[model samples]
Target: MASSNVTSFSHSTFVLIGIPGLEAAHVWIAFPLCSIYIITLLGNATILFIIKTEPSLHAPMYIFLSILAVIDLLLSTSTMPKMLTLLWFDSTVISFNACLVQMFLIHSLSAIESTILLAMAFDRFVAICHPLRHASILTNPLTAKITLMAVIRGALFFVPLPLLIKRLPFCRKNILTHSYCVHQDVMKLACGDTTPNIVYGLMAILMVMGVDSLLIFLSYVLILRAVLKLASRERLKAFNTCVSHLCAVLIFYIPLIGLSVIHRFGNRLAPTAHIIMGNVYLFVPPVLNPIVYGAKTKQIRRRIVRIRTEQKGKITGIYKNKQMIKW
Candidate 1:
């Protein structure tokens, strides 16, 4: 096995095919992808900025959101630049080490994002279910601990994946299906026995995503029970706080689960279908998370409106000054 593995090693570097079967349209696709990347960066940054400057928004929920914003920034940054490069400059060659690093960041950040969402759910649960003790329960130190745990859990779990891939020798199949590297995609290209990779990969997903999803569901179920007992008006008001989170959850998990299922079971689908789903999974959440939260949350919406109003007033005052000088 060792001799065969050594003899079959053919690729010292990996090539990322931006989108399989869409080589001709790479340039055209870059336009919208670039737009989305810009939106993701600006939106998440704005969220972080607002949450930081506004003391009124410094509660546990907003703190978790700010943490989430940071995660989204990292998550999108990991892939969008290289993807745009592949689309525009047509430079597809990536070193082995760089590919592993990208893979680690992408997968681990995703897992971290999932964990953050779970943390957000718990915040909601405390606020709505135990309104009296919300402040006491989700203290600053506890929140920090939760955030740290999420980061450490995500980082440690996926750290071994790239190592596992490093042991396998590629046999001339260096082209990746998407713009970024993923464990499953990279592992499939190896010529060596991948049972360990497959088993560990499944175990990691089940432990992180699987357990998180289940706990989030359980949290919401309890929240629903608590919410139903409130007066009609109070019930609406209470549930409104959860809307942004639910939207965030759906946008993040639906695409993620869809991508995974398609990869495992939808082998009959076109490469384009797989590629499109991959883009949606990676791109849509960052672009939409800030928008959803800013629009849906009353405080964020008010702050944004006030900022716009203040800026408009300043611009008008400047125009009046210019007119006075002309007169």
Candidate 2:
């Protein structure tokens, strides 16, 4: 009788876990998150457009920036919309399959972004530290190949996570806290032992985020050493070129690390910290990347200005021609 009661309770708990929160906080959270999503989408889209249309921005650096923008846009889209809906309309329901899909996309895009940042670091190292070899080394074909490999690696790394989650026997307690369908949050609701899920999750963190960050660090170290060997003015110039990338890397990785730490060791603090860090991690890079790479880079800025100017001229020409036709 006790065993049957236990099983029944488990099933009931599972059904209730994902129901939307009732407080005003849900609406509050949803509004700001929705705003951020809009800003992130527009910012990243603009960056992609500017890079695509501008011939002067066709270097390896801008190519990598475009890739990063693409990754950010997808990443934001994967998690933010559902979160907004959940917050605003009290729709906390996600089907098991839908949750797994969301988790896969979130992880895949995050992994891809990390790898692209590493690639961007390599581009900087070559351009500043080895200017003569930059073109030869990062040829169009090679750049395309590298981008392809990054996407492939990201997908391969995260492929198992969703599979593992889907395989879990979710007897009950499916309520996911916070906002979106994160792996850890979803796993917390599993009725069966989640040892394998936890292990796989940790392994992914160790391999993808850990390894990619390490390689990026090494790339910077080599760049610094090479820059130091140059004349003082040249060294300063080389270092200056890295400032934006460095800022972007810090903005991206720091909050991610903080969120991970909070999720792992600080459960009590996870709710507030997770939401804050989650927003930062998701939206900051998308908003800042364009400013860092586009606003700060001379060539990119000039191209943006030129594009805007040409667009304005076309609009003006069309308006004038329409008026003349009317007259």
**Winning candidate number (lDDT):** 1
lDDT of 1 by residue, 1-327 (tens): 012332343456677777766678989999999999999999999899899989999998999899889988998898899989888998787788988999999889989989999999999999999999999999999999999999999999999999999998777456777778899989989889999999999999999999999999999999999999999999999999999999999998999899999989988998888889999999999999999999998889898998899999999999999999999
Q: How many collisions per candidate?
A: 0, 6
The lDDT of model 2 is: 0.77
The residue pairs in collision within model 1 are none
Q: Give each model a TM-score.
A: 0.95, 0.87
lDDT of 1 at 217: 95
lDDT of 2 by residue, 1-327 (tens): 012333443332322121233355677766666777787787778888888888877988888888888888888887777767666665656666777787788888888888888888999888877789999999999889989998999899888987887777776535555566678877886778789989988998889889989988999999989998999988888898888788888978998898788778887763555666766776677777777776677777787788789999999999999999999
Model 1 alpha-carbon miss at residue 48, Å: 0.6
Lowest lDDT 10-mer window, candidate 2? 11-20
Q: Candidate 1: list runs displaced more than 4 Å.
A: 1-10
What is the clash tally of candidate 2? 6
Judge candidate 1 against the unseen true structure and give its global Cα lDDT, from 0 to 1.
Answer: 0.90
Model 2 per-residue lDDT at 25: 69
